[model samples]
Target: MYKHALAAAAAAAFIHLPSTAAEVVTQWNFNSLPADGATGTGTTAAAIGSGTASLVGGATASFASGDASGGSSDPASGDDSGWNLTTFAAQGTGSGTRGAQFAVSTAGFENLVISFDLRHSNTSARHELLQISLDGISFSDFALFDADAGGDRWYTGRTVDLSAVAGASDNASFAFRVVSAFAPTTGQYAATGVGSSYGTSGTWRMDMVTLSGTAIAPVPEPGAMALLLAGLGVIGTVVRRRA
Candidate 1:
């Protein structure tokens, strides 16, 4: 009976739901743009996976390619290459700040996961923020971390669970923004804001942005399920023989 129970659970793990592809919802390789540094003023739209990837930024922000220290994690220059951020403005100016924004529609998705790779060319500690929005206009804070600490191979990776923010909306328009710290007060660091020193010369790069989720509960492949069932059967037979 005990062996039988284990076999049942194992088989259950392989039970598949109907029409589950587990396809990628959205992805951005950024290979379409030129390798040289170019500031993005308008929206750069591309069809990715099952949705459209819209890359946009303000007047101060643009996408360029300069950081070479990312090594293998950094995407190579190709036909469909990766997009890098080149923030070349001071923060806290309100009007003359620089950041990168990506907007997309995540409809009919559940248990979503959002991830990306980032690298920076900062000489000192500068903070950058990752924000999310349900509507494209207003953004709420999500994560704040050091964009570049000037270490070896400073390329960093982040993965966020988007289950709560995504909810169950068919036309849920989601947006993500990476912004440097704004102008500082009497007692503040230049973490989020790109300094004037940076304004003249500083850069950030990003690549391999992806969003994925399952519409239905995940199950093992048919062949895998069959194998699991067979293994469980073998275990049960062995247990009975021992008893």
Candidate 2:
């Protein structure tokens, strides 16, 4: 009886084990490999995993220094670059319409989370909106970031948690965007700096874009299932004999 109880307890413990630990599903450091010594040169390809990074809403992209304006969260010593984006809509136009987008497959993962480092120019939009899409077509707003501290400085570790969105988990068409948004109440764009005016030429630099989640546990193999069933049978036989 004691052995049967022990076996039962062990099975229960194994069955109730927690989900797998969170892992980086995709990441883009935007830094050049091999220390190219040129901050103006980098790749948009994901540094850690497979994904696509693209400009959205008429925004143009170029590589810029990640070590400028007190630097980003990147630890690379040389050739650390960030994606510099510009060509925003003119003042009082295209609210929430211009910026960058990244698409990644989130299959077999759950509890989605996204993070990035961004630098807003003094003349850039003060309000930035984060949007997500499960179908890769229609997007819904998820979070809004205010660069109230002014621009020409780094804002590291901007994060959005999507653990509550059931469709975000294990989806093949997961995508997200960060776009310039109108001010909360005014319905007009505001400049990042205290006295600066919003402009189409202002830039937004982005680095360390990352997506993470917990991997879904795999189903038990046939051999493992057979072993478990055999163990249960032995435990049942022992209990019956003792009774």
C-alpha RMSD for every candidate: 8.1, 3.7
What's the CA RMSD of model 1 in angstroms? Answer: 8.1
TM-score of each: 0.59, 0.87
What digit string (tens of lDDT, one per residue) describes model 1 on residues 1-243? 766676666556645445545556777655544433332322245436644544334423345442346532434443323344553444334322346676767666676676777665542226556777777778777776665445223444567776676442244677777665542342233532344234424555656667777675445678887787787777678777867
lDDT of 2 by residue, 91-142 (tens): 8788888999999999989989999999999998988999999998888899
CA-lDDT, candidates in order: 0.55, 0.90
Which window of ten consecutive residues has the lowest lDDT sum in model 1? 35-44
List the pairs of residues colliding in candidate 1: 30-81, 31-80, 31-81, 39-62, 40-62, 92-183, 127-191, 180-192, 181-192, 181-193
On lDDT, the candidate that comes out on top is 2
Stretches > 4 Å off in candidate 1? 1-23, 33-47, 50-67, 72-80, 87-91, 95-97, 123-125, 151-154, 166-170, 182-197, 216-243
After superposition, the stretches of candidate 2 with alpha carbons farther than 4 Å from their true spots are 1-19, 221-226, 232-243
On TM-score, the candidate that comes out on top is 2
Residue 23, candidate 2: Cα error in Å is 0.9
How many clashes show up in model 1?
10
